[model samples]
Target: MSGLDQRRVLVTGASGTFGRQLCAAFTAAGARVVGVDRQPGSIDGVPVLGCDLTDPATVPPVVAAAVDRLGGLDLLVNNAGVGGPAPAELPPDEVVRQQLEVNLLAAWRTTAAALPALEAARGRVVFVASRMALLPLPLAAAYGVSKRALVAYADALRHEVGTHVGVSVVYPSMVASPIHDSTADAGLSLEGVSRPEPVQGVVAAILRAATARRAPRDVATTRRGRLELAFARHAPTLADRLVRRTVATRIAAGDLDAAPLAAGMLRRHRDATG
Candidate 1:
């Protein structure tokens, strides 16, 4: 699991800002990558296959095709996800279901489909969860729930795979991505959104997790990210409170609609203290 030279990798949601960056990074690291997304597009000279992840019938075949094209997969990056800002009028249940479909169910189906290949390669599975998974937010009930379920799924899969195949779940905080755009479309402000780390940062982490000799069940790449994980593990109530306060502050400032506001605040705070 050290070198990625010629190893085959599958990255879901390749068209995404993170996904595309991840595919490029993996390719640069010498892995033969197959990018999967709902849109057909190429990344770093890698093939991008279109597949509707939410549709059970469509996901398996796409994975199968990716396996055939790459010969076999040594790593799987489940990065495709959605944060539906259900209109203020939508029922809570409907909102929750949409998030579950894209975030949890899709990840499950892809992992299940790729099991044999992952087992044969003794490779790794990387689940891209979020800080919300560790610390829930008020309006993001569905997104938080789906991420929590994903975390559980990753944990269970790690046990099921044992030492034969590695599994790692990453919890990234407020990454700059199209997720904000989606949220805004649903009527939420983009303020207090954390600037996304370079897509390469996440890609590097995924590569490290995949190639590591000993993979852990979870990895948080940032200080804040790690702290959030600790809070979730030891004092979930505390973590919840912190998140609630942060969101509340944003709402009160009327900056919630500002794209990249979260990132701006984080950067400003860091700069001031540093």
Candidate 2:
């Protein structure tokens, strides 16, 4: 029998592109799935409770409801997040804070709320971080930082609870989904984004990460993501050169902000290298 057969899974961001796909995939594997999202939506008759992840009081009850529905929890997928892409020089603090709260703190609260059930079932926990976490993209510092912090939290949590619960984080490159629509509409340039990974491919990787006997330290969904991660680790100067080049191109195209704004970022990279 497949490992997922009869598993009880709780998926956050159930209304999102990746979340919806995960809910469907897990349900098809015979897992009893319960989902949560701020938006009122459902998938294949699966129960998707609506609650703001940023609100601490709202979390416990929703997690309780999910656990009760599934008879217990076997998996928790923290996929809810927002992307605020803009000139890193002047990201809106409100937007940055919202990203941190939702993408980082919310994952903590939801996992903490569900840990007891997860431990009892010896289930797994998954965090849907981003490719930006590995190699910070230009004009998207807030998204990168939040995801980076989330991955760090995942590492710590995995070590703390690895004896009972599996822990993994998936870093996906661009996907053909509305998740990037808001960023594009906000006038953030997407020049650095590689060809999008199929939604199905990403969902499959997430399942593997979540159900593995030993969850990996990290997971990436695309070739570009893998290469960037390698470059960031073994070739920092090369990575910085490519990123700076992209930033310069964006500045020349007027897709980014003023000259000084871009200059500051370049200076920081050079300073860090030297």
Candidate 3:
């Protein structure tokens, strides 16, 4: 676990921007990388498996294939996620349920399937969560709820694996990625976006956290990001109020759109405070 060299790594949603980058970065780090997506193809010579993560039955076999191909998994990156406009007027319960199914349940299924291998290798699991998980925003009710669940899931998983497997959750701000294209169709915008943290940074952090004997529960790009973690710990109510104010300001400015604006505002607050 000291190095990615020869370590087996699996990345879900490998066809997407972040997932593709993650696969490339891990390969560059000398890990034997396996990419899984709903698409059939390969990236940078890495094999890509076509699997539907939403189907509970598909996850275990996918993990088994990855283990078979790589011998065993040292790292599992739960990077697959979905978000789109769900009619602002929709019932909160319905929207939240769908969001949880895709963003939270899918990750849970994937992690559960990979846990034994991870425990066997005493490896690591990385969750690519959003800033919304920490701070709630206005229009993104479902997305926010799902991310919050993911944060809870990661925390619980960390404790469950205590001193056995490493668990790291990353909360990234707006990044220029195709996710914007999909969400934009649903009234989202990626304007004024923070530069996507080089995929290498995330891969490196995962490698470090997993291989290292002890890994931190979370990793963020900036001090402000770190500060959000602190605020979440010390003053959750104050944090919620601060987030609400920022979302209000964005709405007033008309710079925020319906889809991603809430998440965008939370990212801005994180950046400003960090």
Candidate 4:
């Protein structure tokens, strides 16, 4: 984990915005990289295997293939995730299930499959979580819940495997990607609520975590993200108040007016505060 040179790395979601950049960066640093994605292709000269990570039956064999291709696994980056908006007031639905399956369970299964190779090499695992895991927003319950659960999984994995395999979680603030397409289509666009950061910074943060002398417990991609994480952790009540205010302002401005999925919460917010 001290460096990337000659390291055999397997990254999930290799065809994604962050995944492509990550492969390029790692390749430039002299690491042997392979990627797993739903779309099998090459990114930055890195080969990506096509696999549906959410399918429990396929993750093990896909991971084994990557390990065998790389000769051995030195690092596993769980970068694959999906996002959508689901209101907290609503009952769990397909959106909720998809988020949990992809964002949380997919990483868990991938990591579990990669553990033997990682432990044998005394390697590392880095999970690409999100700022939502720490500081959540309204109308995006699925994404928040899944990411938070991913972090919890990472924490537990660290406890169980800390002796040999290093575990780390990197939280990036909003990065503009197709991951937000579903949310935008749902009329819950985070246009003003969350700032979209560059994908490079997030990739860099993940690289740092992968190469750090000792795997850091949690890493935030930007200065603002670190502050947000600290505020959410140290003063949760205040953090809640701030989030409430943002949601209220958005509601007052009719931001959620077009989102039918947000109707119940919008009606309740208007009734209670009007």
Q: What clash count goes with each model?
A: 10, 0, 1, 0
lDDT, candidate 2, residue 45?
81
Candidate 2 lDDT over 53-156, as tens digits, reads 99999999989988998899888999888885555678467878988999999999999999999999888898999877877876678889999999999989
Measured by TM-score, the strongest candidate is: 4
lDDT of 1 by residue, 57-175 (tens): 99899999999999998989999988856422236766678789989999999999999999998888899998778676555667888999999999898888866788898877776
> What RMSD, rounded to one decimal, does every model reach?
6.5, 3.6, 5.6, 0.9
Candidate with top lDDT is 4
Which model, 1 or 2, shows the larger lDDT?
Answer: 2
Candidate 3: which pairs clash? 224-274
Which sequence of candidate numbers ranks them by lDDT, best first? 4, 2, 1, 3
Put the candidates in TM-score order, highest first.
4, 2, 1, 3
How much lDDT does candidate 2 score?
Answer: 0.82
Give Cα distance to truth, residue 213, candidate 4, Å.
0.3
Q: Which residue pairs of candidate 2 clash? A: none
Q: Name the candidate, 2 or 3, with the larger TM-score value.
A: 2
